[model samples]
Target: MTNTHIKTLTAAILFVPLLAFAAAPGSTDSIETRHGRVDVIADADATHLLVAGKKIATLGVGSASLFRITSAAEREYIIVQGSRPGLHCHYSYRLLALSDSGPKVSKEFGECLDLGGAGMSGAEPVVHLNSRVDPEAGVETYQWQGDDVNLVFESPTLCGATGFVAQKNAAPVRAPLASRVKGSGRLQFLSAPDAGCAMPGVFVVPGDKVTATLASAAFVYASYTNPKSGRKVQGWVPRERLSDL
Candidate 1:
């Protein structure tokens, strides 16, 4: 998946075959979902999907292709996919929850070499995300439990071979909140938000106050004195992982 984001970017740059949708000339447009109305707004000349009037996600320029509404367990889901056509079509998907607050992104697959079979359902409703990389392929099935999403199942293996199923691993445990010496609780911690990015040599525990040294659209690079080892460490983590204190 190293070229995932690159492929998405390239698709955005390429000329897209326009779909059959009527446009109202304005800064924003609205579409109805099972949960609520989603408005696509223009911000700084870029297109963004707004839920509850809040910017939930940005739509790649010229990359908008299809919108699919999926129903499971009496709830609704909105799927927006961008694909680049060729011998090996490159594509990416964003899974959103249709909720009272609007739509919230649950999973983002930057760009897949080959993607298929996004539908899945059960008592709780699961969304299947699959990708194939040459001879190796994998599937990650996720379920939205309340407002949080959980990766309940995963299988990876050589193409056309039987794959072993495994439960998704839990997030790393953090130190107690009482030990926090610095940094606001709103600050997010991450494990690489994008492909090919380096993860921290060790995970940052909650109690450690880390200094953010760099910022990007998707991640922040932070440094902190490790409480366990007393050594200084730094790495890139996703901006979405941190919540308000």
Candidate 2:
């Protein structure tokens, strides 16, 4: 055999193993061969990044193919990494495994429909707010679980306020509505008086943080009311106590 042929064959044998070894530690092709068939496949129909069949990160890819295996907290993740040398820019993908599990555990307003049989008045999933206000303490709220909660609290009072579960990155993670909403919408805010801030209740669905704009535009309206502020008013309720809201 020609020297060139021998050199090429040697390079091929060495390179192939190195590539598969980097896929995942203790998951080398050689190791897998010692066990059984290696299942690394790229499902083109899938919405994720995959290298040699294992899913990697998948967020965005612009004709540039780059993916890696990143480790985190004893977990192995197929990570996607890409950069344009000519364009001098980089990109990444947020690839994920499609679950064979049924449509995620969904929650509906029907579950939280009656606020667990709580006497919440006004339109279902909606309450009417006249020019008046509720003098009693505790604010109005609705929810099934943290995951599927669609809370909206607002007051027209100069002390007018608004609150609800604010959503962060709407990554569709496989989880029950309750578990998914943890650490989400934990914060609260109040609208400037001039903004006529209307906190509308939301019709939330599990795994639906996407297509959801927690921005100024996504503000739902619970109802409309007017709390004469500049003018005289009843004694103030302590901030700690929501008696005035």
Candidate 3:
């Protein structure tokens, strides 16, 4: 109940740790009930975890950590946490955004960028994003959502920077596509030929179902299908291809 949280940034494939989390059956302390998917880092990068909107823990951890994404009833919870066997750590890990340095709660990170004026993380909180950027006009800046996913926009004079999300206090008929819209990126609209892009070692666009391996950086532009969302448009495909984004 202490509400302690941490943020970190590191460079690793998105689901490598998830693979381990899914495989470890011997550790009774192993994490279960992951709603989405996650990655864990160690060492000096642990400084990113924050609690109650304040910096709390660092990467100084020996206990096992778990990354989980839990979605239920139109809600998704992407989580990264560490725990001992029934030992209370006093922190409820919540991701402000995934970054390369690690989980981040600092305002300098994209999780704290202009961030629109939407209310989030208080009630049935959800972080929605659909911001369009134009690089030719010098708009794209740095985006850090943990350590493995920090990016500076390279596409210039582009579109699809629509950052929008919807919330309802009363039961309403129209359900907002906030998750789909906020998660959608303009890049997915890019036309892909048999091959991908040639941004001079800048980005490797995936043509079909691809894998995000370690040390691999690809600015993927893809259109995907989700049972929850109709047709997700564009988003920087996670080197891990997170969902239909």
Candidate 4:
């Protein structure tokens, strides 16, 4: 080969290896905490959870494309979601704890359902699991005490209704039936108390009487008896929408 041809061939041989390394699997990432940093690596076979360069766990991808990492308070967790063929799904979560000895895996929770969402809630940062139990979805709360995570509250998952378990309040006194203020226009009824939950629409007309069954900080649960059909309609209505009859 000529001198120029030999130089060109030599350059190609050196460049190919660098390209392969960039595309290689088993890449690693890190997230920093108050004390040190946590490490994660993804390989062809499974994703590895590491801390201080020591592998703590190997999480297979299973039916998911990747894993999701999230943090709450001072705690960190890894989440993986996957679906099966028969409308079944799984949500897996593993909590990571950092100590002086090393990084340790605290607890692993695997929930089987259609799979919805999980997050921290309430004043003490309890874990809340929101799943589609029936046609409706509600929250099941768990409190972490010491090394034990105990189920605390389970909300009813019924369409157009709300109930709670383990609530320590006296029976809710239904407010005397009240009429929609004459000039209040149309009251806005929601499927849930939160504004973005769902707006099913106002089920009652102006001046219709509605009894408040439950009251919260921002809204009231009201039930109305239709004058014509006698069917009962109940939903969340803004507390500002009704006046004493």
Candidate 5:
């Protein structure tokens, strides 16, 4: 082949893939899935989710910043995250499951500060949703079952604040009260009341104030707020590790 012809052919070959994969002005990169390629296209007024060129769902005026296909227990799903319409601090998410008929929205959450970390928990797909207005509400855990979405857990928010308080049972051995961490060592925070629940790596040193609620025989739900960062974390702490203050 002539030198000019060979150069032209090489350039055309390199440009083909770019044309095939390049997203339109207002769309996210395509998410390849077993069912098909998933995409979120945004226009002046709304954003649309499409699978294999078939429209699956739509959101109000917003731009999709996240789009991906994930699987759990052998089932495939599409997760989309974006800003909530007319809200600067809030975001929204849509969860869709793939089927023989195509992909369909199973759950939709709005007015969230963030939604991400799509992963697997045993046979279930898990995601975290944090509230924009309620910092004390902490992060919410959601799991997918077939085509449905379930709220499996809500992490504890800051103590002394009027927000979500996880209750393991109808009644507590001790009523909610202000308390302080005991001992010179750090007290670890657990995700649940049970010791088997994973520790969230949060700790409170001696004299750190905490609001103890939902007390069981051995454990008490404690919420601790960092004075400087204003960050909060709540979880179960052994009842013996705290002292009434």
Candidate 6:
């Protein structure tokens, strides 16, 4: 063969093996866990969950995406997000725990766009998932408890702007006996503590006097007495909208 042809042939030989061993597009690498490596293998028909090369579970029939893998002292937790066939916007997640018997579903949360990101909060790792269609469904927060995942908190706001759970269990403190609405516009008084709930037509405008009794992370339970009707309306209002008088 000519030297030019020989060099091209040699290069082709070197490249063939690299192609054979190359990772396929859309294939995810194995993730290390406390037990072993975990993998999500997808095909045209189904998506499979594997541990140490052994098939553990079938995640779904369509698309499945790995959200997170968290390890604790006893076991490893895997969060997988998937959508139903033909419903791209409707998504859900499954929490799987790795055990000696195999990997098993710990918990399942449905009807979310995409579960919020996972991260560390102090010493504990936590995951937050937000609702896709229902704003009132709010956000669900989870944390690892040994091998199992626990839903520790649920926020009333879409962005999870509340720390109510942390303050929920704390010793009760004295709040201002009375306060006045301080915002420029009318503040919605929700029937429930959640801001996402439909307004019941109850509203408090600036300079309106209200009594603050109970308080949550982002809202406060207020009793407002209408001066004209002499009627008392009790509901939850945004905490920031009230000022101590």
Q: Clashing residue pairs, candidate 4?
A: 26-42
Which residue pairs in candidate 1 have backbone atoms (N, alpha carbon, C) closer than 3 angstroms, thus clashing? 188-242
Off by over 4 Å in 6: 1-29, 69-72, 99-102, 119-126, 132-137, 142-153, 158-162, 165-245
Q: Considering every candidate listed, which one attains the maximal lDDT?
A: 5
Q: How are the candidates ranked when ordered by lDDT, highest leading? A: 5, 6, 4, 1, 3, 2
Worst 10 residues of 3 by lDDT: 1-10
Higher-scoring candidate on lDDT, 3 or 4: 4
Candidate 4 residue-wise lDDT, 30-127, digit = tens = 65555465555666666666666767777643333222233334553333332222445444444454545455554545455322233233212233
Model 1, span 129-188: residue lDDT tens: 565564245555455667656766555521101011101111222431122323444333
RMSD of each: 17.1, 23.3, 19.4, 16.8, 15.9, 16.5
- For this target, which candidate reaches the highest TM-score against the unseen true structure? 5
Q: With candidate 2 superimposed using the best TM-score fit, by how many Å does residue 214's alpha carbon deviate from the native?
A: 13
Per-candidate Cα lDDT values, in order, are 0.43, 0.22, 0.27, 0.45, 0.57, 0.56
Q: 84-198, model 5: which lDDT tens digit per residue?
A: 5556665666676766676667667635556423444334455556654555556665667666787766555311111122342313545568888888798888654444343
| Candidate 4 wrongly placed segments (more than 4 Å) | 1-24, 30-38, 51-56, 60-115, 123-185, 196-202, 213-217, 227-230, 240-245
The number of residue pairs in model 2 that clash at the backbone is 19
Q: Estimate candidate 4's alpha-carbon lDDT, on a 0 to 1 scale.
A: 0.45
Better of 5 and 6 by TM-score: 5
In order of listing, the candidates' clash counts read 1, 19, 45, 1, 1, 0
Please give, for residues 21-43, the per-residue lDDT of candidate 3 as tens digits.
Answer: 41122222223222222333333
Scored by lDDT, model 2 comes in at 0.22
* lDDT preference between candidates 4 and 5, better one: 5
- Comparing candidate 3 with candidate 5, which one achieves the higher TM-score? 5
* Poorest stretch of ten by lDDT in candidate 4: 11-20
